[model samples]
Target chain A: MPVNHSRQKRGIAISPKNNSPVSLFFEGAKDTFPLIVGAIPFGIIFGTLAATAGLSFGATMGMSLFVFAGASQFVCVSLVTAGVAWPMIVLTTFVVNLRHMLYGATMVFFYKNLNPLWKMVLAFGLTDETFAVAVSRYSKNDGVPGKHYYNLGSMVFMYGNWNLCTFIGLTAGKAFPGISQWGLDFAMPATFIGIVIPYLVSKPMWASVITAGTVSILAGGLPHKLGLMMAALAGVAAGVICEKVFSEKKERI
Target chain B: MFETGIQLYEIYMVAGMALVTFGIRYIMFPLSGRLRFPELFERGLRYVPPVVLTAIIVPSVLMPTGETLNLKLNNPYLIGAITACAVGGLFKNLLLTIVVSMAVFLGAQWAFAMGW
Candidate 1:
């Protein structure tokens, strides 16, 4: 398992304890708390911006309640504000959210044996922060059963926090009219930096980050935010190629 | 004087976004049991998080305005992101990283605005 392999390489001991479903669930929520902090500004900003974008309070809250993805919601609201057609707005949302497909694929290994209902519920909650927290927990070979409960916990916590923040933003936006311009949106990127920096433990990872970062900046002008998808692909390709090349060199030596 | 709170097109748009977003997220779940990916492809998937996150972060920090690059020292976002990267590298604590970075970001913004 990648968890065991990485832990061994890092000289960290894997805990041998097994956790009950209840504990795992709460642990999931607790571990995801910091990420929720990062997401607060993001959720609130979305609400505030959506309100300003001419989305009714109902529509703004509806997006949070149903769509539940921060980045895509932002894109959708921005497109609406631009006076784009509804179909085009939806298409952009689809494109913006395609990264979640990769997340879903990564998570499939853990949920393959789960019941359909459990799988569906968990999949709906698979945002970037939840995935970050849950994957690290799942990756640990701590022999924990019902790890999906941990995911459920994080999901519920995040869902609640997001909606609450959106509500705050909606109310605050009307009051302050300048809350969105306070640079609060920096929280998301700061949180992302925290997530990514720790994963840069290998050359392939570094290659992936550098390539993706550069490509995203260079292609940032692409229509409908397609640059994000392009940058992601380029980054993954770079990582895979570097991994192969480096492993081949080790074999040759 | 007849006004429903939300317009019909807005409802349609939100519904469409919800459907597609859920479709992307849930598509793999139903197929989970029946699907087995190649090992090479699986390896590539591990890179997805870092890559996707970096793609998002790079643009947000470098182009906070969403229209132009802001690499100058006065750009609080750039300063804050760099602070975050360094702090996270050294400490590896998520909350600490966020708190410290946000403080730095705000401080930078204040200083620049004050002509300091």
Candidate 2:
């Protein structure tokens, strides 16, 4: 007779832990390498641009390491270079990274049952790539990926990618080799376009996009670069109102 | 060089910057503690992305001359970016979206270089 062991139990289907800590730390560097190949050049450009924009290498690296979002960092450096005040810099960063707030709200549904440390670490480790991966994994037919390890690995990889590439770019991110005549600066707007396209997945999403675009257009000239703040607030306001109205109507029906 | 009045230490400023960033990120941490946000607040939060993303990217697309308006006739980046958006919504693929938009940007810039 074949021996069938019914003793083993799967707790939420994550994984059997094997040398968890060391593995988690390096996993970030390894898995994110493919993404990093593209990201590094971008990081290098941000660093080089930041250097030209008058940030110290330490500050540049610190911002890249600690924060890890590209558009917001670019806006922060650009605005500072343009001589916007300190408060405006802080506000701009908030406005730009505000999207992550949405990511947090959605993740709470999946992660609420996790321990405090997991919640805190997941919150801290939140980034575009990690969140995108984690949320999809959490929502799919299969359960979340080795929840802690997957995110930890991706975060670590991304952190190394951003910092190291930034250092390299700072040292040697010349426009000459890439052929400045080629208009490589479009990478940013192009990237934003890439993100925005994925988001037109629903009615509310579409509403948010139009609202964000319109308000941003209207508030484009706010002083101290406050236009961005207004745009963010306006976009959120429009979408929220529409959603509320839609839901209320559905309930009434 | 004036290095005295009103200036902060380098390390302190770095810490301050990091603190400010973390503070902004942690703002969403309270979501759990509140069993429910003000009904209005919850609804609005749902719509935040579209509004904010538009605000973030529109200027990049439309405002090349700083404050002046440059439409399809003048700036090619805007045209390419818009096409990329259409491609993205239609195709629903990141790779295709990136490739299409990037090609638009490069092609337009190249044409400009060749003076065509």
Candidate 3:
């Protein structure tokens, strides 16, 4: 009865009854393009950095494929470079990736009617960027399927792009001495700002960000980048406390 | 380094870390039916920055020197970083942030090289 139940695999959208859903999936893909474009450069940098940190090419790409997690992989490289014990390296990576649990849980609710096979396939691929795209689509369209295809497609695309670019970067980083001095490293912060600024258009969010940024600066010198963690905790704590303190006020858009 | 014998110590550490990561990732699966978390937990999760972003950005900004701010005029990296944040906020563009920060830092270094 739904618009996408038929011709699910071919991506045909012309059926009078089934056009909307196929279009919606493509729509999801279109939305994810920026994220993939983002993946290319970010992946290149990760590869370059991992090599700079002394990881082998096989290890870096393997980490990307097996973990498919950008930041935690970087942390692993950092820990290894610093000669931290292997156990702690693993623990830190796990702790840093804890946010994925929330993502898996939230997206699962959307795909509730789908078979369990699709759920397992998707649960592993849902990263923040894909989750953002999927959540916005679900909220806007209301007819989105309870399946995880969009998340799967986006994640797989990004993962492939990243590994490819990372390999390119790894080769270049090794071949060219002092390559980092050329200033390609600035891409990382700029990317985060690009993402964060759009989210700060709302006032409460503005408060939350400023609080986090300032606190991070204050705690910038803490060991093991723990200050950064505290800053995040502080920022979100501020948001939650502010919301609770003002609960009695009438709700306004 | 560990072609065949990475050592039990290393194995335990890496495997332990892997387990921790797995536990964190599937954190919700075990609790889906067991506990009634307060609304605060849900609210906290929503308000928090995505985990990867927080770990990446926060650590780099706070501890670029490996453990300290490494603050000093000679540390052009810090200047470049701050320039990234300020210019990043004003323009809200990624390319501009990368360009401006790198340019300013390199420009400053150039001037310094010229005895400014």
Candidate 4:
């Protein structure tokens, strides 16, 4: 009960009995609102840039609706603008989105008992913001049932906001042609810092952040955004190694 | 004829992007209930978010233009990101951190443009 009390202070639900799926859904949306604010500029910039890059309205909207991944959509549009072939565009998309596989792997444990259809729906919305929010929720020891509604809530809210922001950007882009160049995309990195800084509580986590950050900057020139993947792998490996070393030291002590 | 060809090209490209994106995201779903990872692998999974997010945040903050490192004081991105880190660390409030950071970034941009 004390543990639940502390979690409740942190805004997690106290127990399953007090939370209905509908309330959980709303709570999820409310929690995700901050990250959604962070993403608004990103989605709008994508739309403005895609239009500037000469993508048809249909194509731009279709990519947002279908692909639904922010970073990959940006990469795809840039590649298209550069006259890259479709196959290469797709390849870049694949590479840009490979990090989602790691996200999916981390989430699979929580969702292993979920229905396949539910898993499918959630997977479509497993973006950086949604995953960040949902993983924090899932990791809490609050014994809440139907928490997937929370995930669904975050996903639907983000999905709708992204598309709507894209529409606004497309419409406003022609009117204010310089909107995309305003460097408003800084919101994303700012949001990421907020999300990540709270998690740097352990030696392994610090190792992971340092390794990944260094490797990414060092390999920033890699083609097709491969630097991201390299940095991620190096970071994870460093964390795992540090975790092992630290735990072994603790055992000896 | 030319119009139709362009439309077709766009369609093909969008479809290709959709397929690859969805495939990567959904690959682990079908295997979720069926597969179990090793203990070490499971422990390693905990680091994925911090690592991936940091990998993204670092380069984007340090190299906003993606062409060069901008560690100068005039770089709004670097200034704003550092402020965000400090605010987040102290307040641990997401919305407040974002708002304050954006304000700082905008102010920095204006000052730098004025030759400050």
- Top candidate by lDDT: 1
- Backbone clashes in model 3, listed as residue pairs: A3-A18, A87-B13, A90-B17, A111-A146
| Candidate 4 C-alpha lDDT tens digits along B1-116 | 00112377889889998888888888987766587778888888888988899989999988988899988887899999989999999999999999999999989988988998
For each prediction in turn, the share of the native Cα contacts (below 8 Å between chains A and B) that it retains comes to 0.79, 0.47, 0.29, 0.73
lDDT string, candidate 3, A79-149, tens digits: 88798877677767766676677665555446656665665555556666676666656545535453255
Which window of ten consecutive residues has the lowest lDDT sum in model 3 chain B? B1-10
TM-score of each: 0.93, 0.75, 0.72, 0.93
Clashes (N, CA, C under 3 Å) per candidate: 0, 7, 4, 0
Give the Å error, residue A253, model 4: 1.4
Runs in model 3 lying further than 4 Å from the true structure:
A1-26, A52-54, A102-116, A222-224, A251-253, B1-22, B50-116
- Residues B1-116 of candidate 1: C-alpha lDDT, one tens digit per residue: 11229889988988999899889989987766677788998999989998999999999999998999999987899999999999999999999999999999989888988999
DockQ (C-alpha) of model 4? 0.60
Report the poorest 10 consecutive residues by lDDT, candidate 1 chain A.
A9-18
Least lDDT summed over 10 consecutive residues: which range in candidate 2 chain A? A1-10
State candidate 4's TM-score: 0.93
**How does residue A136 of candidate 4 score in lDDT?**
94
Question: How big an interface RMSD has model 3?
Answer: 4.5
TM-score head-to-head 1 vs 4, winner: 4
* Candidate 2 local lDDT, residue B17: 53
Best of the two (2, 4) by DockQ: 4
Error of 4 at A89 (Å): 0.4
Candidates by DockQ, descending order: 1, 4, 2, 3
Candidate 1 regions with alpha-carbon error over 4 angstroms: A1-18, B1-4, B32-35
- lDDT of candidate 3 at residue A210, scale 0 to 100: 70
